[model samples]
Target: MFDTEREIIESKIRLCLDCGKCTVVCPVAQHDPEFNPRLIAQRRLSQNSHSPQDETIWQCISCYMCVERCNYYVKFPEFIHGLRAEALAEGAQLQCTHGGALQALQHMMAREDLLQDRLSWLPQDIELSEQSDTIFFVGCAPYFDIVFSDLEVNTLKGVEGALRLLNRAQIPFNILANERCCGRDLLLQGDREGFLALAKANMQEFARYGVKKIITNCPECHYTLKVDYPNVLGDTGIQVMHLTEVIAPLVQSGELSLGELEKRATYHDPCTLGRCSRIFDEPRQILRAVTGLDVVEMEQSREKALCCGASPWVYCGAVNRQIQDQRLTQATATGADILVTTCPKCQIHLRCAQKSRDGKIPQVEIQDLAFLAARSLDIGGESVG
Candidate 1:
């Protein structure tokens, strides 16, 4: 499902005409000159038959803005994912601090105890359904790792929220504790072997559950499951959904009440969430429902929103710091006191960017829509943001 290397991808590049329309609309380009999708596509075509270019290719956040803006309809994430795979084949991997994150991901996957312990945030007695039509898969992130302590709680809340919505709507879902990491990090880092392993594990677990649909809050997980899984796992009869997509209907029907929120805020579209999956409205609709909250739109909004600069991995020192400053400045310029997003990765990176700003510029509060929605609903919850 992730493969994009074919005559068609090359054909799209040839037709690109170097229009630069994609660059003008790229979210990453707003904050990062190093991450121009158009330039990357041009470079891929000029390469000596798949020779790896600079590490910047790996820096793409899998946001689909480039595709949306490009007249060629080039598949940005598939191309980048393929490029990273080829780079590793050429003996180049993640550059800078991103390499450290790669190591951490590998370590967590290798240690089952760590994986099990990662979900310590839930109660031991909390009931988890073993048989239902749908299952909620929560992707691993720093916030879920740090705050939940027990991975079960953070994962459970997602399931709980889904279950609550489902219960009210009479929709039921099963919980799969055996689901492993979606291997998106490895895929982004070009660890094809690791990605395949995790994919196989997740596929086997999904098979055991015998479900036809899967829902997850994490865009990374949603992307991996919906796009990549089918390539390796065949037709598992599963439809992957973001929690926002699943909950939107419930919210629309008044199953999930939108409570009072009195603040000015803007939304950051997660590359994996909005760009990769074309999910731009569900989160926005939720935000809109909040009473008295002003939802400010950034100059680069929706399909053209800027990247948070923390995915494929973080750059170190001045490079990453500078990118963060640029994003914060844009967010603050919206005249919003808070910035909301759906992806945990976006939340973490933006918050880090916020902290790095440290009052030098007008600082805006960073938060995930889940936490914000939870706040709106008076549902007790915590966020890494």
Candidate 2:
């Protein structure tokens, strides 16, 4: 166990220039006056004392906004990640959203004897190539469908859409027969051991199937596979790609032509794909390719895109709802017929805000980019929708 506290203090927190910019732009600090990134930094560096158990450590939604605005490139979200790990190391219990069910599921997936019934939801029409080295990393869509059933969130729509598009284009790809969660939430919630176990299991599966490349629609899974794995485990010699990266180029090259969709839509940039990975254009490119679909931009988009209120599935409540409502309001402001995003979690959280009985939040139609695209795809020279 590395000294997360000491490392964060020395490498990131201590580099703070006492600038209050992080707090000013932080969504949490903006709402809760008690939370300040600058103050947190000061406390960590205080000669008197330091405590990772501070509530502020878990309040961060891990939006990467601080990293976006920091002049010195201080990774505040990452600092909190380290602090959360430190807190857990000291036996501090963290409240995982969804009653810690999702976290527990990830832990269970790490077990060697676990058998994953991951393919029951897969439709028969989308054929898989057993010989293909490229695999569609489904992430936790199957489990999410069960967990968020109350919200009626169909995360598998995106996965099915991805498969449909790939099949339409005659792209050979396979799905993991026994896939596991990417452990992004676990890692972000400071469960390093859990994350490593999942990572190890995933890596073993990848090697077993000779998976040289991964294509996933879920932004969190894409980010975890593409960036987080390499960062924590060194080079695993794999190419990780978001579904947008695959679809956009095919559309642009005229290999895949999308049918007309007479609807106005606004795109939500998933933090993982846009801000973190700098993948701003690929989704937009595919969206723009569809005929009759009027694309509108939200006021805060691209680098300044608002997060969908929660991440890593922990401690989500008022602040998360506020952020989600704010984002939904922005999407509504564009007069879009639908709010399209690449992240399934974004689809859920944004829609969850609209479900509130208070009716204060706007009830905008939310669709995953892949699902929307699949509905508009021209397969067999006929429009699917």
Candidate 3:
């Protein structure tokens, strides 16, 4: 922890007494010993380790399990994120493949051609509430990129479904067409300046748009806006909500029926939403409301759920693949056909991992909750027509 950058972040590391509890509860360590949160915790505790070059740092899936499980209340994820940020700042490069992903994020954020085109996924018939109180701040992810190709068109079905639910219930909301990346990836990757710039830009946009409250479909975006934004924006008087929480009430009120899914399903808790923000029940409740579906629980569910392996501001492909495989293996063991997740990042990355694997491992379906809700739109369907 005596590293120049480590000491700078030491205030946050005030009292991590080498308790291996972080290790015990960490899925990265459980799935692969190469990743030991306790060891990282210990290194963070050590005062002499200069220029540590551990590949395991790149292996962290950015899952907040260690932080949540830490009895000492160490913000382990923050520590890890800080460590990664230091590495990037020092020009300490990981494999180029993962680095390239960061480059792609930079390119995406800097280019409106990529950003605006993705928004086309929304059904033209779907109404855009430009003057509403809430804005669903969809993050940049491969899932939404595919769906919203015309502005996330392929994926607008989910957003449209939620909007329909809101509209049917008369909830006022709108969207920011000029919204940029939430800077989560950059922030996690140790690009402090980059992150700050993106955050400031977004904060300005939110203020300009009169975005009193924000709802996000991506846990990473949700965590960035809800948890990190305030520290930088100085109390912008905005609220950040996960889509599940926003729509869970609708399902509970019988306003959004999930329709009948005569199949077994399991839910994957994204680290950003579940551990980062303590959001576990909302998504589960949304799933439970669906008719004819058996919601099975994997050995690791809720706070203990394994990470989908592509977050925390960096993308180490090999390690992430390992984590994703372990998660998929565990998910497959539950005998569930559909593995539902709320975060677009988790859904897209897991889908990429699922496609990378060979056949016969339960054709696990990965979908966002909004897709199911849209399918249950008893009233919105006629309106879309």
Among these predictions, the greatest lDDT belongs to 2
Clashes of 1: 8
Please rank every candidate by TM-score, starting with the best.
2, 3, 1
TM-score, structure 2 vs. true? 0.95
Which stretches of model 1 miss by more than 4 angstroms? 1-11, 26-40, 47-55, 96-102, 107-115, 123-127, 142-144, 147-171, 314-320, 382-385
Off by over 4 Å in 2: 1-11, 378-385
| Candidate 3 CA-lDDT value | 0.70
Query: How well does candidate 2 score on lDDT at residue 299?
Result: 94
Instruction: Please tell me which model should have the higher TM-score, number 1 or number 3.
Output: 3
Model 1, 1-385: lDDT tens digits are 4453662364366677788887777655665677677788777778465544566775565656678877768766667777777777778745646347555665456443433544455434334566776876756752344543432223334434444444444556666655677887777666777787788777777776787888777788888899777765676678988878877877788776767788999998877787677888988888887888899988677777767766555334454556567677888888997888766666656666655566675567766676666666555243323
Instruction: Answer with 2 or 3, whichever has the higher lDDT.
Output: 2
RMSD of each: 4.2, 2.2, 4.1
